[model samples]
Target chain A: MKVLNEMSVNFESRSVNEAFARTAAAAFAAQLDPTVAELNEIRTAVSEAVTNCVVHAYRDTIGIISMNIRIAEGNILIVKIRDRGCGIEDIPRAMEPLFTTSPEDERAGLGFAVMQSFTDKLTVRSKPGKGTTVTLEKRLSPRLSDV
Target chain B: MLLKPKTMFDGKVLTVYLSGDIDHHSARRIREYTDALIGELKPVRLLLNYSAVSFMDSSGIGLIMGRYRMMKLYGGSVSVVSIPPALRKMMELSGLGCLDVLEGGNEENESA
Candidate 1:
């Protein structure tokens, strides 16, 4: 897909940045003229991804979390969040609903599930001790005006 | 930023009014404070008011599930009220509806 627009950002994996990252993703996605519901879905998906970096990836210490957002042809919004912290040993198990490693922290283990449900496509790639990258893609509905 | 919750207790019900965005960071504070109140008041019902919540992700679900478990341990019940449309969708996707904690409309009611 041809990238019409793109932006990249790197921030510390702090819990506070979770809100910032999601809001930033929504702002960047506004160029696609997504409806309120669409924008919210994007924001929610981004929040879950960033939160994983803060809570699980860099569990012991703070690390840099990188995000790349691109608006492609056909009003497709693609968001990629990556962390160079401890990678997931089991991607499938991690994505399973209600499966959380940190239950004591009150994690519902619904992050990946939420991301998958809110976005059209969700991709997760990780290698233990290497890193983890989560990509979310959504095709915004065509506006009547555009048609 | 973590916005403190406004809580009220009426003998049998402990109502917590949660506001602002509930992400991982804010959820921690809300959970701790709400749990402390639940432990102290030990009400028969725990009402979580989300009318003022502007945004929430899975962390909010965790908060509700934790509270549900906590209340169940004491034989109490947990109910979520005034959930926004976006948040209601999130709750449904997370299968929180089965718990039967979701109640009432999106607008904050005077009775609550």
Candidate 2:
């Protein structure tokens, strides 16, 4: 797929940055002229991805979380969030709804589920002891103004 | 930024007014504060007002689930009120709606 526009950002894997990451993604996706619902979905997906990096990936210490946003052809918005911390041992199990590693922390384990529900496509690539990368893709609805 | 939740407690019910974004960062603080109140008040019912919540994700689900568990331990029940339309899908996806925690239907209740 041809990329129309792209932006990359790296920030500390802190919970506070979760809002920043998602808001930045939404701002970047605004070029697609997404509806309110589309914009909200993107923000929620990005928040879940970044929160994973902060809570699960870098559980014990602070680390760097890198996010890349791209607008691909056909008005598709692609978001990539990466963390160079403790990676997932089993991607499939981790993605299961309500399967949280940190139950003690009151995590409902709905992060992956929410992302999947909100986005058009969800991809996870990880290696234990290496890192994790989550890619979210959503096709924006074509607006009448665009037509 | 942490949005402090406003709480009102009658003898039998505790209402928590939650606003702004409910993400991991904010959820932690809110959980801690609200849990303390639940421990102290021990209301028969816990009502969470989401009329002003602008954004939420899975963290919001976690918050509700945690509160539900807490209330259950105290022989109390939990219900959500005034969920914004934007967050209705999230509540549905998390099966909170199935649990009947959504006080009224999915309609946005501004006056709540």
Candidate 3:
């Protein structure tokens, strides 16, 4: 298959990787003529999803989180974030808002919810212990609009 | 990511100004500091001046919700002021409007 326009990156620490993902996504979306708000929605949504992989999936362990940024159908932006860490056991239960298995931590279980809130679409595929992949899809607008 | 808390009126109205980006990593600390300050200062009111905040994600929402919860218990109110229109939309969708997310400055309560 022929590869389209895309960006791939990796980081050792979770602290800066999410920021880098958003920055990289913004740079790409900006070139596509998306408004700042739309870009932010895409960026923040991607960041939240990726951060989930970092903080929850792997728990800040040493792993490579991969991001694939590609434009789809002229106006849609798609991002796939995957991590080879401890995967999710129950997909449906985990997707629920405020559903965190870890109560010892202060997680609000808003990571996936926030991603879903900002993005046009989101899909999570995971196993019990192998790894997890979170895909975020957004339809970009020409300009950033505030309602 | 620097946190600047501006104390006004003998520390009656404590407005904590957050700059830079708010995300998963920073949300934890922000929540901790905010809760500690709220307990210690015990202000009459609180406001999050996000004027300098360049970016925020879902973690930001959690922090705001946490503060809102804390404020309710103390009989005080927490307001978000000077939000950029883009960020404002996020707040609006998150039910901050129904929760009464303030949209103006402290001018309304200056004389209070």
User: Chain B of model 1: TM-score?
Assistant: 0.92
Compared with the true structure, what per-residue lDDT tens digits does model 1 show for residues A52-106? 9999999979999999999998989999999999999989999999999999999
Q: Which stretches of candidate 1 lie over 4 Å from their true place?
A: A144-147, B106-112
- Of 2 and 3, the candidate ahead on lDDT is 2
How far residue B41's Cα lies from its native spot in candidate 1, in Å, is 1.4
- DockQ score for model 3: 0.45
Q: Supply the TM-score for candidate 3.
A: 0.84
Q: Write the per-residue lDDT of candidate 1 for residues B1-112, one digit (tens) a residue.
A: 2657888888999989999899998999999899899888899999898888889999999999999999999999999998877787898887888888988575445344
The lDDT values for all models are 0.91, 0.91, 0.75
Number of the top lDDT candidate: 1
Error of 3 at B103 (Å): 4.5
> Tens-digit lDDT track for model 2 on B1-112?
2656888887999999998999999998999999999999889999998888999988899999889988999989999988888998998898887777777744444364
lDDT of 2 by residue, A28-127 (tens): 9998999999999999999999999999999979999999999988899999999999999999999999899999988889999999999999999999
Ranking by lDDT: 1, 2, 3
Minimum summed lDDT over a 10-residue window in model 3 chain A is located at: A138-147
Candidate 3, pairs of clashing residues = A35-A144
Q: Top DockQ: which candidate number?
A: 2
After aligning candidate 1 to the native by TM-score, how far in Å is the CA of A40 from where it should be? 0.4
- Considering only N, C-alpha and C atoms within 3 Å, which residue pairs clash in candidate 2? none
